[model samples]
Target chain A: SQELEQSPQSLIVQEGKNLTINCTSSKTLYGLYWYKQKYGEGLIFLMMLQKGGEEKSHEKITAKLDEKKQQSSLHITASQPSHAGIYLCGADWTGATNKLIFGTGTLLAVQP
Target chain B: GAGVSQSPSNKVTEKGKDVELRCDPISGHTALYWYRQSLGQGLEFLIYFQGNSAPDKSGLPSDRFSAERTGGSVSTLTIQRTQQEDSAVYLCASRPDSNEKLFFGSGTQLSVL
Candidate 1:
């Protein structure tokens, strides 16, 4: 079975600080997605990176996928209080089933 | 446009009881998914439905879990013989297709005591 491992299970940073979260997979990832969940709210889709060595950015957040398709990273530039949430990474499997396996998630807290 | 909506924001039930959670996807969306978020298990995928196609039940943890989608719009997830481990937030999401962006519901917080 495929699995995703996320680093720094919990992080707290002062506002305007930079932070990075990492996700590594034990199996080759076909497509990777990043989501953010606020307290008592549903997850919001952030970005998706498919090809290896691909990079995508939304505002201050940038995500990168490794060429080997085994690892990915999410970087936050000048983090804000709004960036505080539980960040999760998921990988989609190929074929008809096409189920997504999610990581345990990284809890991020950006203080004022 | 309305995003995904779930019913009964919270549920509290005794162990061994059965509970049902409902999800209303956005209009015209063809793909819907169910997921569980527990303290120990984190967030786990449960099942996915795409239009009239057969649902993928491989992610279900046990036989007590089942889900059904009606008219390709609304979905219901039923858990029988619930245990304390079933205490968590059940989230629902829908996408235009299996590989498209997902819009999630606020989720139902289930508590088994």
Candidate 2:
């Protein structure tokens, strides 16, 4: 049903430039997670936000969940070549399934 | 301290045949999941197994798609009478618990001709 939507299907930036990716959901998000996958590989977990208005950071990546509880943003500061990959956002809705519904993804190209 | 692992990094098969993919989750991890990723597409949830309980098969695309996890460790996904539409990278993931972050495997690339 495409509950989650992401913007800027693809993005390119200089190696040192900063970038932001957005994710919005039609339904309230019970849990929000961000993951990155390189070419032909598995996704690596980046961060997760459960409560609205919560923010978390890892290294140069900072993620925030809006207080409205239907949106999230991933910010990468001082991006590097290694940051090139597909970034996916997944949401866990209310249910016993707890299954993750993923967005199409955002392809990030960090040009050196 | 190894992460999840999948066997047969790549598989090429013809239609009407059967294929089996294996996944070995991290030791002691109780939650396991199977997902499929079409080329340049988002991950598609297939099935999930938590410990020794009954698996949640609601996401399976069809009756031909079935999976089993034995002894709460190794798991296998089987597809019978495969079609070209079944071609995709099958990914496996595991987490210590339902609330923890998932650890994924490299995945098995299946090409059904």
Candidate 3:
């Protein structure tokens, strides 16, 4: 079985500051996904990374997967109050099954 | 129709009662999944349905939990003799066969009293 561990379980940052959240897996990652969830709401898809050393950005948010494929990071530039929520990283372990294993999640609080 | 939809946005049930949660995936999606999210915790995979058959159900926590999909469109998750530990938000997701991205529903918040 594989597990994902996220660093900085909870973080509080100023609205204009920058921050980074990391997700590490015990095994090599085949497919990695990032999602955001508001309180008591469903998750919204953010980005997905497949190949190792891959990087993708949406607006001010950027995500990178390491060459080893065992670690990934999400970076937010000029954070906003709207970025305050739980960010989760999900991994596709088997590739065939749509079942994704998720990390405990990082709670981000961007103070205005 | 546009995205995954779950029924009974909130459910409050007493112990020893049975409850069923429904999920309606996006039209034409062949892959559907069910996950549980406890308070302050990550999502836990419960089951996956490919079309009308379930190829993986190993994530189910107990025998008391069961789910079924019919006609490759709708899914229902049933919990028998619900326990307090069963309280959580059940989320449903669906994706097309061509991609790995999953579209999620608002989820059903279940409170077992």
Candidate 4:
């Protein structure tokens, strides 16, 4: 089984502060996905990176897949209270038949 | 529905009882998935259905857990003789295919007591 480790299990930042979360996998990732969730709510899809050295950004949030495809990072700029939520990194387990293996998750709290 | 929909937003069942959770994927979607989320843990992959065929089911924890997708649309995850450890949120998701973005349901909070 492939394992994904995320750093800083939880974080708290004041509004307008920038922050970053990292996701590292035990194996090379074929596809990396990002999702955000509010407590007790469904995960909201953010972005997907399929190629090495790929980078995608949505609004203030940006995600990048490393050249080795074994790590990824999510960066938020000028964060706002609305950015408070749990962020999860998922990977297409390569030969695992399309089921995404997910990381433990990072909880973000933004104070205004 | 606009997105994946799961039934019984919350369920409280006694230990050893059988329970079935439902998932209704978005129309026209050929891929549906079931995942379990325990408190403070990541989303655990449970099962995947692609066009009525389950090419992967290794994520199922035990024989007590089984899921079925019918007509390539709706899916049901049943836990036979549920245990206290089964207490968690059951989430359903769907995507266009293995390479696309996934949309998830709010999930059903299951409490086995």
Candidate 5:
């Protein structure tokens, strides 16, 4: 089964600092989605990138896909305490059903 | 409902009991999916339903797990004779026709003791 490797597995940063989380895959991704999950809560959709080298931003967060569509990075600028959560990246590569294979996830802790 | 809705936000059952989790996708959406999330783990694909096509159940962990979509709108996931390791967050998501965005439900937290 295809899987995504997200690193660093966990990160802690100052509230005003910038942080970047990376998700890498061996196979080409048809679609990549970024989501945030709070403890004991559902995942919140953040962004989706399909086209190679595509970049999308929402608020202070930005997501970019590599030219090969096999790697993606999420960048958060001037993070706040509210930015602390488990970040997960899901991808579709099989071209099968709408099922997505997710990464192990990055746990971000922003200290105020 | 404005977004995906799941019933029984939390479930606690005995190890040998059967459990059912329900999900109602967004209105008019054609694609529905179920995934399991263990603590500190990624989402595990379970099943998918698209239109009237046969559902894809390739991700189910075992025969103890089964899901069904009725009338193209709602879905139910059943776990029979659950084990202690069956505890996890069951998440449901729905995507509209020709779209990549998947709206997710709040998920049901299942714990088998």
Candidate 6:
């Protein structure tokens, strides 16, 4: 079974500060996805990285897949209150079913 | 639908009772998925439905859990003899195909007492 581990299970940052969240997989990553979710709401898609060494950005957030394709990172610059949420990283481990295996998630809190 | 829609945003049922959750995926979507999220926990994959082929129920936690998709559109997830541990938010997601990203529904919060 494949597992995903996220570092800094919870984070608290002051507005305008920058922070990074890491997601590492036990197996090679075929496809990596980043999603943000409110406390009890559905997830909002952030970005997807398939190829190793791929990087994508949206607004102040940027996601990168390491060259080895086993780890990925999400970076937020000038964090705001709206940035506070649970960040999850999902991997497409099974190519056939396309079911995603998600990490425990990193809870981010941006203090004003 | 514009996106995946789940009914009964919240449900409260007695233990040992059965509950059914519904999900209406986006039109033309070929794949639908069910996931569970407990308090302060990550999402757990429950089942996967792709096209007319047999669904992948490998992720189902137990025989008490079952789901079905009709006409490759709407899907229903039923939990029999629900227990207290069954309390969680059941999320439904759908994608156009295997290679596309998924769109999630608001989810149904179930509380088994």
Scoring each candidate complex against the real one, what DockQ results? 0.63, 0.64, 0.67, 0.75, 0.66, 0.68
In order, candidate lDDTs are 0.89, 0.91, 0.90, 0.90, 0.91, 0.92
Worst 10 residues of 6 chain B by lDDT: B94-103
What's the count of clashing pairs in each model shown? 0, 0, 0, 0, 0, 0
Question: Compared with the true structure, what per-residue lDDT tens digits does model 4 show for residues B1-113?
Answer: 88788999999999999999999999998888889999977889888888856447888999999999877888999999999999999999999877788889999999999
- Native A-B contact fraction in model 2: 0.58
Cα distance off (Å), candidate 2, residue A74: 0.5
lDDT of 2 at B2: 97
- Which pairs of residues collide in model 3? none
Q: Judged by lDDT, which candidate is best?
A: 6
Residues A1-112, candidate 1: write the lDDT tens digits: 2378998889999999999999998877788899998887678899998898999999999999999988999999999999999999988756546677789999999999
Kindly indicate the candidate among 1 and 6 with the higher TM-score: 6
Looking at model 3, give its docking quality level. Answer: medium
Deviation (Å) of A43 in candidate 5: 1.4
lDDT tens digits, residue span B2-93, model 3: 78999999999999999999999999999888999999988898998887564589889999999999888899999999999999999999
Displacement of residue B77 (Cα, Å) in model 4 is 0.4
Q: What is the lDDT of residue A111 in candidate 1?
A: 94
Q: Give a tens-digit lDDT track for model 2, residues A1-112.
A: 2788987789999999999999999988888999999997679899999898999999999999999789999999999999999999987765546676788899999999
Better model by TM-score: candidate 2 vs candidate 3: 3
**What is model 2's interface RMSD?**
1.6
lDDT ranking from best candidate downward: 6, 5, 2, 3, 4, 1
Q: Is candidate 5 or candidate 6 better by lDDT?
A: 6
Classify candidate 2 by CAPRI docking class: medium
Alpha-carbon error at B112 in model 2, in Å? 1.4
lDDT of 6 by residue, A1-112 (tens): 2389987899999999999999999878888999999886789999999998999999999999999999999999999999999999988864446777788889999999
lDDT for each residue of candidate 6 in B1-113, tens digit (9 for 90 to 100): 67889999999999999999999999999999999999988888899999998999988999999999999999999999999999999999998888678899999999999
Against the hidden reference, what TM-scores do the models get? 0.92, 0.92, 0.95, 0.94, 0.95, 0.96
Considering chain A alone, what is the TM-score of candidate 3? Answer: 0.93
RMSD of 1: 1.9
lDDT string for model 5 (B58-95, tens) is: 99999999999999999999999999999999999998
